[model samples]
Every structure is written in structure tokens, then in C-alpha cells.
Target: MLQDYTIKKQPTKTSKLIASIEFILVLLAIQGVLLLFNQEVPTSEVAQFRILANSNTAEDQRIKQEVQKKIAPLLDQAISQSTTQQQLHDRLQHLEPTIEQLAGEYANGSAVTFEHKAALIPPKRIGFAIQQQDVYDAYILKIGKGKGDNWWCALFPKVCYPEEATVTETEEEPVKFFVWEWIKSWFS
Candidate 1:
């Protein structure tokens, strides 16, 4: 006959201390990873960019003002010096083709739109014109040229081939067929 003996074991204080330390280390590591995942960049870099842009814009304006001031006297002197109607007529004649083209385009049914830099024109000067295609079809128009190089950078077509236009059959997802309407509607 064989008798089996079962001994009850008690956990030591050393084991408890080791378990507590391991728990604390795991918490610290978790916190560190969380902090890394949700890291916040300092605002000082954004502030610096804003300051630089403002300074450059101010400088550019100052330069333009100076140039205009310097040229004003010369323009006045040239006007005073010239007495011929022939000179004035010649200048007008040069611009006559552009005027005629603009007038012709306006007379025809076309989608016309213009872009300008921010806050250049007063709201009062902004007027809407609609060109009719038939009795019910028409497109709204706005006319103004952009002032800055940056404005035209995206607008102008380059030597490279244009990106392929995506076609959507769904009525909800409208595709652009006209340049002016597309651009105006996109920004607005």
C-alpha cells in the first residue's frame, strides 16, 4: 500500500516584490509607447514660417511702391513732353484687337471665368453675367486676371501632357467638361 502526501506552499515576500516591480515596468513601457504614438510637434516652427512669409510679402510690397514712385515722375515728364495725337492713337490701335476679341467672346455663348488674388477687388465691383445657350441653358461668368505668379502656377498648362480626365457615369459625381466652370465651382 502506498500513501500520497500533498504539501501546501506559501508565496514569499520576495516573489510579491518581484511581481510589483514587473507590473510597474510594464505600465511605464506602455505609457512610453502611447506618448510616442500621440507625439505633438512644437508650435514654434509654424510661427517661424508665418513670420517669414509676412516679412517677405511686406518687402515685396515696399519694393513695388518704391518702383512706382520712381517711375511716376518719368511718366509725367513723357506725357508733358509728347504733344501728338498720333502717339495716343497708335497705343489705342494696339489694344483694339484684344478689346474686339473680348467683345466677340462675350457676345457668343461661352463659359467665361477669371481668377484674381485674394481681396484685390471690392465686393461692390464684383458683378455676375450670364450667357444663354438656348432659352433655359446658361452659364454664369466672372472676369478678372490673377496678380501673382503663384496663382498662375497651377492654372497654366505646361509642356508635359495633362493628366487623364476621370469619367464618372453617376449623376452625383459630376465630371468637369468646361475649364472655367470646373475651376470656379471647385474652389467655391
Candidate 2:
């Protein structure tokens, strides 16, 4: 007498459940890694512009406003033409004498200084995005004492102006599968 035998392997219910759980954990880990990398993208590449008033007095405030008005158009023109941070810096440098002249006209002959440097800026809302407190390359126009309230805005992105500026909301990138949606699909 002779006999033939064959073997077949099938996954049990428990094994299938374990495999699904493992797959979900792996997906979640990958999502976390992607989020981490996304967060690491640099935000310090932008340039800023600031105007510091001489004092908080009514007259000084008026002078600051005047100076801002006179320089706003110049800044807008220069910023609009610039395509890079370095170009912005160079344009500001070239315009320093003109800026000082404009400030002196409104500042009653008070000395004004134009400086480009890295400075710690406070948190502020620029257009749509809220800029966090951090060090940034800034073009500062210091008037006389430079001890009063300051006006600031982004220069490289060209979002700053004396008037109210609006930023169109950008659409977010769509994710392939959200965690909640993935979980629901797995159970169903």
C-alpha cells in the first residue's frame, strides 16, 4: 500500500487581527516621522523691517507716523523689486542715506540711523501667519532716541505696509490617509 499527503497553511482570526494591529502601528510611526521632518523646515530665511519712534509723546508719535508714510512707498518699491534676502539688504543699504534724509525731514533734524543686523523679534501677526519670537535679519530705522513703540513687518515676503494688508489663505496639502479615517476603515 502507498499514501500521498499535502499540507496547507491558513491564517487564523487571531493572527489576522495581530497583523492588522501591527500594520496600523507601523503607519502611525511613519506619519509621525513625516510630521517631524516637515516641522524641521527652516523659517528664519525671511528678512524684517522695523521703525522705532523717538519717544511716546504726541509730537514724536506724529513724527513717527509721518516718517513711516514717507518711507513706506520707498520700501514697497524696493521690496517689490528684490527677489532675495541679500538683494533686500543691498537695496536697504543703498537707500540708507535717502531714508535718513526722509526721517530727518519729519524728525525735526533729529539723528536717524539705518542698521542691518540680527535681532530678537517679539511674536507678531504678519498678514495671515503669526510669527513666533525668534532672531531674524532686520533692517532697523532708529529715530533719535529710538525708545518708543516700534512698527515692524516682514520685508522679504513684502507683506508690510502702513495700511492694512491682507493675505489669501493657502490650501493645505492633502494627506493620503488620516489616522482616524484609517482606523475606521480597518474596523469596518
Candidate 3:
């Protein structure tokens, strides 16, 4: 009996194209899921207080610090006592004059203005939580030109200082995705 040999046919162009498209689709799906996972969710409903400095000079920076020091205690007290956003807003509004006076005194009579608005704040580490870039209801205390770096803290939740804030174990742990891990294992 003669020995038989078999020749395997090469994949067709269409089949190759389909395979490439399928691979791309899988990649896109994975990317989409990862993007979704990376999305940041606010851990708590809280308001932010941001104080912008007039300039980056030593004097301006010192003034900003002084203003923050004066306002921190008052903010902490008001925020701790308030329960809702409205209450916090009302409290901040009530304290606007006092805050302005403090800022003005430290900033050499620099015009101080208070603005309440939804602002896009960048990623920040507030006490124990890392906040992502998102729009938040903020009480902005603009000093003088309002053209310098800002100091921000969670005013409503009273997480301004690390020592004063409490962090749970779950909050400190990083987010895990078992499904993503399995998918990665398959690729590996």
C-alpha cells in the first residue's frame, strides 16, 4: 500500500479578515469593560470648599494659609452640624461675610468673593479617599485675582484634615476585578 500524504490548505483571505475583525472586537470589548471599571464613583455625598490664592508669591501663599487656618475650624463646625446640601449651602452663605473678612485681613484687603457652583475638580486625595475628576458642588472662595493654585477639602463630610478623618478598611483596599483577571489568564 502506498503511503498517503495530506496537504493542509492555507487560510483564505476572507477568513483571515474575519479573524482579524473578531480579534479587534474582542480587544475593544475588553477595553470598554476596563474603562467602565476605571470610572470613579463618589463614595459619599459631600460638598467641597476651594480657596484660590491671588498669586504664587510668598506673601500671597502665606495669606492663603492664614485664611485657610481661620476658616477651617468654622467650616468643620458648620459642616459637622449640617446634614444636607441645602443646610451646608445655607451655612456657607451665612458665613460668607465672616470668611470674606478673614480673607481680606490676611490678603491685605484683597477683594474676596464667594461663589457656589458645580465645578470640574481634578483628581484629589481627600484624607483617605481619592476623588476622581468630576463635577461637584463647590464653595469657591476667590481672593483678589483668583489666578493661582487652590486649596481644596471636603467641607460637608468634614474630611479636611487627615487626623480628623476616619477611613474604613474596605475604603483603603483597592478595587478588584475577578472577571478581568480570568480574561487576562485566558490571554496569558
Q: Write the per-residue lDDT of candidate 3 for residues 27-67, one digit (tens) a residue.
A: 89998876666644563477878888898788887888899
Model 2, 1-188: lDDT tens digits are 76877878786766767877898799899988765654332457777788888887889889888999999999999899999888888888899999999998888878899888887776676544567877788888889988775444443222333233335435658866676685566466
Better of 1 and 2 by TM-score: 2
Q: How high is the lDDT of residue 97 in model 3?
A: 92
- Against the correct fold, how does model 3 do in TM-score? 0.57
Model 2: residues with Cα > 4 Å off, grouped in runs: 1-42, 150-188
What TM-score does each of the candidates earn? 0.20, 0.57, 0.57
Flag clash pairs in model 2. Answer: none
| Residue 2 alpha-carbon offset, candidate 3, angstroms | 64
Q: Stretches of candidate 1 above 4 Å error?
A: 1-6, 41-188
Q: Which candidate number would show the highest lDDT if scored against the true structure?
A: 2
List the global CA lDDT of all models: 0.35, 0.77, 0.76
lDDT of 3: 0.76
